[model samples]
Target: MILKKEHIQELKNKLLEKKEQLLKESNLSHSIIKELLTEPSYDEVDYAEVSSDSYNLNILREKQLVVLKEIEWALKKIENNTYGVCEMCDSPVGLKRLKVKPHARFCIECREAFEKEQKNSR
Candidate 1:
């Protein structure tokens, strides 16, 4: 389907919003790390002492970085007029699906398949 100008605008808006939100979150994480560094924790600050919740924080930060990369890639796809096209499959991912997951590179079926493959490979 030929993506309309309005649809492109909507996606651009969403991408911009996502990029801004990610930047804000990354900035917040940087601040937290900086603050924690300056305070000089009385206890060891290794990953072990980082607390279970903070371990999740590390995972979250890693996920955020990956999301940021995907967002940037999507922005590039928009520029190249290939947004909503699956990378693993030469299929036009439905606009409805894209609306729900703007950063998605594959449709649900393909995504699930790839995820399963990744798990198996891992």
Candidate 2:
């Protein structure tokens, strides 16, 4: 089904909001990671704790970067008038799914199959 103009605009707004939030979070994570790197640890325990925190922050930042890229791609699709279509099956990604994740690239069936394939490969 073709998405109505209003629905597309709504989804665009959601995507933009999420992108902005992620960018802000990424900046904060960077600052924390930098601080953690520059601080002097007083003992082995302290050093280990700092290292663990830094690792976790880096992982979170990496996840945010992936989502940011997806959001960018979704925004571009919106501009190209091809938003809300599944990348794998060329079907509508359903308004409910889009509302929950505006950057989703596949319909539920395709997404499940892709995930199962990924798990089997691993």
Candidate 3:
């Protein structure tokens, strides 16, 4: 089904909001990384805690980067008038799914199948 203009606009708004939030988180993560680089002025236990926090922040930053890329791709799809369509099957991605995952590239069926294939491969 062809997506309504209002729905597309809504999706675009959601993507933009998510992009902004991710960027803010990324900036915070960078600052935390910089702080992590400072001299360890604490005991071994404290140092270990710092290291753990740094590792967690790094993982969070990596995840944000990935989501940011997906959001960018989604914005591009919106510009090209192809947002909300499954890349794998050329079908309309359900509105409910899109609401939950605005940057999704595949519909639920295709995504599940793809995930199953990946799992079987591993």
Candidate 4:
């Protein structure tokens, strides 16, 4: 394994734990959205409170979903023997970075470049 056996196990455990937490949170947000959308007083309810809660739920769900997607991607990378390699620069992302952010697909330098590009685009 590119990762030491122990490290690989730890990564897997962390990803699984995070995945479950995200799924639960995401599902709860989705359920709330559905409830709000189909509320009994569909037209009579206070739009401000409902909209505010929905907006907050959306942001939270969005962040959690992104993390879930990243974890899934990382797991696939591990299966493909491509884990720990930077997707952008093709450099090995050190174990320390992987430990800190197991879903990281790029090294610090490449990540910085990518973020800069993203900021410019926005």
Clash counts for all predictions: 0, 0, 0, 0
- What stretches of model 2 exceed 4 Å from their correct place? 28-51
What tens digits encode model 2's per-residue C-alpha lDDT throughout 81-108? 8888998789999999999999898899
Off by over 4 Å in 3: 28-53
- Across 25-102, the per-residue lDDT of candidate 4 in tens digits comes to 667554553343321210211223445777877766656655666787788778888888887778888789988888
Colliding residue pairs in candidate 2: none
The stretch of ten residues in a row with the least summed lDDT in candidate 1 is: 37-46
Q: Arrange candidates, best lDDT first.
A: 2, 3, 1, 4
TM-score of each: 0.74, 0.78, 0.75, 0.74
RMSD of each: 9.3, 10.2, 10.4, 9.9
Q: Which one is best on TM-score?
A: 2
Candidate 3 lDDT by residue in tens digits, 1-122: 36788888898899989877876867855455444433222111112243577787877776666677677778878888888899889999988888899888889999888777765764
- Candidate 1's displacement at residue 58, Å, is 1.7
Q: Tens digits of per-residue lDDT for model 1 on 86-119? A: 8767788878988887877777889888667765
| lDDT pick, better of 1 and 4 | 1
lDDT of 4 at 7: 85
What are the lDDT scores of the predictions, listed in order?
Answer: 0.71, 0.76, 0.74, 0.70
